[model samples]
Target: MTVEHREAAAQRQEAGAGGPQAAPGRRRVALLFPGQGAQQPGMALGLYRADPRFAARVDEVLALWGAEGRAVRRDWLAPDAPDVPLDDLRRAQPLLFAVDWALGRTVLDWGVRPDALLGHSVGEVAAAALAGVLTLAEAAAVMADRVHHLASAPPGGMLAVAGAPEQVAGLLGEGVVVGAVNGPRQVVVAGAEAPLAAAEARLRAAGLNTRRARTLSAFHSPVVAPAAALGLPVLRSVALRPPRLALHSGYTGGLLDAATAVDPGFWAGQPAAPVLFGPALDGLLAEGRWLLVEAGPAQGLTMLAKRHRAVASGDSAAVALLPARPGDDGREAAAAAAVRDRLAAEALLPV
Candidate 1:
């Protein structure tokens, strides 16, 4: 194995060493919610169709947005429906928020309680709801209003760069900003399309992997500052509460402070704040033996979690509750069963 792979394996083994065998019943587990690019037209269709509880929860959250929610549900469920609106930031944010939140709630109802929670990008809204820091309606409102403000901004794009932040930092030019640090080797840069495309071309020319993320605006960059400012009042209107679960902040790259969690200004700035996922994962890994569950429509976060040094080293395991792609036959049920089986085997869930 390469040195990097070897190191990751070691970390994983160290993380998994004592807990599963010593006190399986109390094994630690962390829940992760994904952000944009994770959405699909038929995502969660199986779960929503076969599981009434799951469907009801999805509807309940969707109801919070009124007509927009209903329209999203229609497109999300209809056969042969195009993912047109799902690509629009204004609509996508709230829809993804509801789906991810519903999935988390469904897992909780199935007795799979998380010991900690982390969220990526807009996924943080759902995480906040699950942590009891915000209600479903409030999260919906935050997401919708945030997107509304964002829609008013000029068009931009994001590029997923497969390199360390330090490596990519030097490549950024005017308008470009580090949108997210997903892992040691995975960073997302966002800005106007012209600058973003130029950066991606340069990175690829240098033999670094780069791809355009499916997004409408340059989220987590200076481009969204105006939107963030506009959304501040909307964010402040929502009531805040202390998290019922341990909540990690992707924006801060660590556990969220209680004071900051309840601050509207903190949330207001989050729209344009870089997602510090890698550092946040490091913090969660320090707690030891966590089962990182991706509670969203896609396995994007789960894939990133698996590549983390901790998981690669065998210090932890990561699983996705849903398929990364839309249209996979029975994949959702299979994924859910896989999670259930793993939790049961670890004694985290009652058999």
Candidate 2:
């Protein structure tokens, strides 16, 4: 095997900490969710029809969180909400979480329970809710409060890195750090503009590839330290439970226990920590077969899953790319239907 593959194997073996497993006779599957920048207009429309309970649960969450007033406007209920007022990060974070939560909840109500759950960046909040670590309302409230807290912090940004982790880390010496390792080489870095620029220059100098992320704020890096540090009170107020499923920590690929999982210090430190998406996938793969479901509005996680599968299988020919089109209901239905079909084909559903 290649050196990279060997490293991935090592990470799998070291991904210690046991979380809940799926019930007997049920094949292990993971429900993945995308974080910020994955939000699109009319995110919950498919679930709104595919499962009525999805809308009901979201309504319950809205009522419980006292955010019922900001419902997705009547016109925004279509497949795209480009004109809707989700421009503000404060509004967007909760809204995106709501959309992603609806997707996961509908899957559950439809009798498709995941063995584990993992969310990227802001999606981690939704994953916490799906794992029963946080209630829907509580997740929404914390996310809203988090966005509010982040806004007052100094400006910073995230950039996507298309290289190995060690190499990327080498390029970012002082301030910038890896935010999310979405795939083998698809990683993100966060830091202030100057540091990020320097890191980018160094990476390019080394012939490494990079792309600036769509995010306006630098999250999961030291840039968010001040904001997260000051937001301790809010984090402490949110009651968190030990995840009932294998909810991999974004800060590390290892599983989290109740004491550390629910601690405010953990969340506070997350902004400055490296995201272990690739390692988390390795840990999941080490267990058994898996049919990854992107339980969110966008297909970013799906894309990442495809990348990992290709890397693991070492057969690009065996991979399939499913793209989600903008403002297309038939496309959404087809995609969800395909997901259902694939889950059954893989015997991932409880018979």
Candidate 3:
């Protein structure tokens, strides 16, 4: 059977243990990692201070980058630190990778293990590492090198358009590309500045709600081809292993074939490949009911996940690991507490 078929069969078997009368607690759990634009300064700060395990994992990831990484972490976690240019894709990618990976580790340490994993865009690197397909150091190196290569690309942008995929695709003229299919009505477009601006303007003029994604360059577009090529060697150098958990691919919008998951070229092309988040997520939900936990700085992916039919039908639940925004003094603490409470209530964690 194909990976998807196998996974579906496995999920059915797992769910069948309790038969039709099985309680909802028998459903599998999934951990999601967010891509770019979900990051924020001081993300998970409360957890870092209140939980040593979380703090240590964050520190461990920073250590991989040596002194520079340490400095970034210092600024990142500082309560009163000035706003760093996290808007720059080069800096944001690695920092976000570290935060996501650290947060995933923290969740696992807390005794909430996911049966399946999915990540969007750069988030996949963290998922790969956490699933044991790549080491933390390897993930960090790949992320850093990816940023370095992408930084050299020409300026570009991404826009989140609230419309059907076909509606969004109709607007992709010339340089523009459909970056991601977030949901049935949520599609992300990316490309050079001019095309992006034109498309955004047109979409808004048509009474469609749209927002500019905070990104330095148009990812998952042809503009990043050179960067993708340059980063291939970095990915190839990393030692890879089979994932310890089922890992869905954001690129293919489905479960990853074991070989493709470890292929260097696959990793390299991901940056320039359209993210089929909506489809991939659909497939994951097909496996079984899941508690979708967003292990990232914000709730962007969590919000998107909620738009899925399974989630909307109450077959699954989605929660963000960190506060959706920064600035509030105790937001992280409250969010963390809320997550724990929700998990316990859902029987995902010990009460």
Candidate 4:
């Protein structure tokens, strides 16, 4: 069966399990990682300085993968590099993963263990590692290989629409498909150049504001089908063990386990399938008020979380997006203090 069918099957199984489960208490929080466009120069500086060991950990992984750590370091250090195109898939994927993983480690150090993890687009690789499904080294290698595979294809792109996904789906028609529902009114669509343009026109005609994505690959659409085919074997080759925590499936809006996630086909299908973010957000809110930590490069996911909160009632819990860029300027202290204060105020953690 195709990845879409398989993911649909998985979601049906999860729904069969029962109604949405509730959180036992305030300990549950979801870490949401941003995808490609989120990367900015000088991101992750706070975490790197707060714990130099975070960068060391990334270095150790890159060394094992025969990858150069300096490239990633440069992006985090001088984000506005005039020479380097920050959005290049090869450069963008791994660098983004490293920054997110570092931020995740920093959060872990603060005694904040996520009850669940959700990553958008390329961020999923780092999420897998953070969830303990893959080692840091394994995560980095798989992501690098995946990006390299993507680079072989000609440049493609995705666009954002602010409207209900069903509405967007109806407007986009044949070529473009729903890539993600970042929030109630925020969705991403992907396809070939003409189809995407057509979809954007329709969306605007339908009164939905639109923005183009920075990604070169038309992710979550059939345009990446060729790339997904090439990456399937690599994804299968990687070992995916059980996660230490619950992981929400991006291809399906359900709680995913390692056994199901280990199928290389599952990972491969994601590139050409719409991310089930809207339903996933529904599942997340059913549990409890989530802190909604954006552990990746930019605040893109955080922006989504804010909109989700605005639309979804019973989601009154505050959401905080920690700074991903590294450097010293009291951000680390401030973020940690915020976490502590939130936890204390909610009695989730000791003061």
> Tens digit of lDDT per residue, candidate 1, span 1-351?
334334533554475421233364245778898888777777888877767888899999888878877777777777366445677885567768888888888878877667778999888889999889998778888877887788898889888998989889888877798999998899999998899888887788878998888788898999888878898887778789877677888998887767989999889998789999888888777766778888897788888888787788876989888877755467777877788788788778745
Sort the candidates on lDDT, descending order.
3, 1, 4, 2
**lDDT of every model, 2 decimals:** 0.80, 0.67, 0.81, 0.69
Cα deviation in Å at residue 188, candidate 2? 0.9
**TM-scores, one per candidate:** 0.90, 0.80, 0.91, 0.83
| Segments of candidate 2 deviating more than 4 angstroms | 1-27, 41-51, 62-88, 309-323
Better of 1 and 2 by TM-score: 1
What is residue 54's positional error in candidate 4, in angstroms? 3.7
Q: List the residue pairs that clash in candidate 3.
A: none
**Compared with the true structure, what per-residue lDDT tens digits does model 2 show for residues 179-213?**
88877788888888888899989998999888887
Cα deviation in Å at residue 291, candidate 4? 2.7
Over the full model, what C-alpha lDDT does candidate 3 score relative to the true structure? Answer: 0.81
Report the lDDT tens digits of candidate 3 across residue range 139-227. 88887788778889999999999899898788768899899998889888999999888888888888899998989789999998887
Clashes per candidate (backbone, < 3 Å): 12, 3, 0, 12
lDDT accuracy of residue 240 in candidate 4 = 78
Candidate 1 accuracy as lDDT: 0.80
Error of 2 at 339 (Å): 1.6
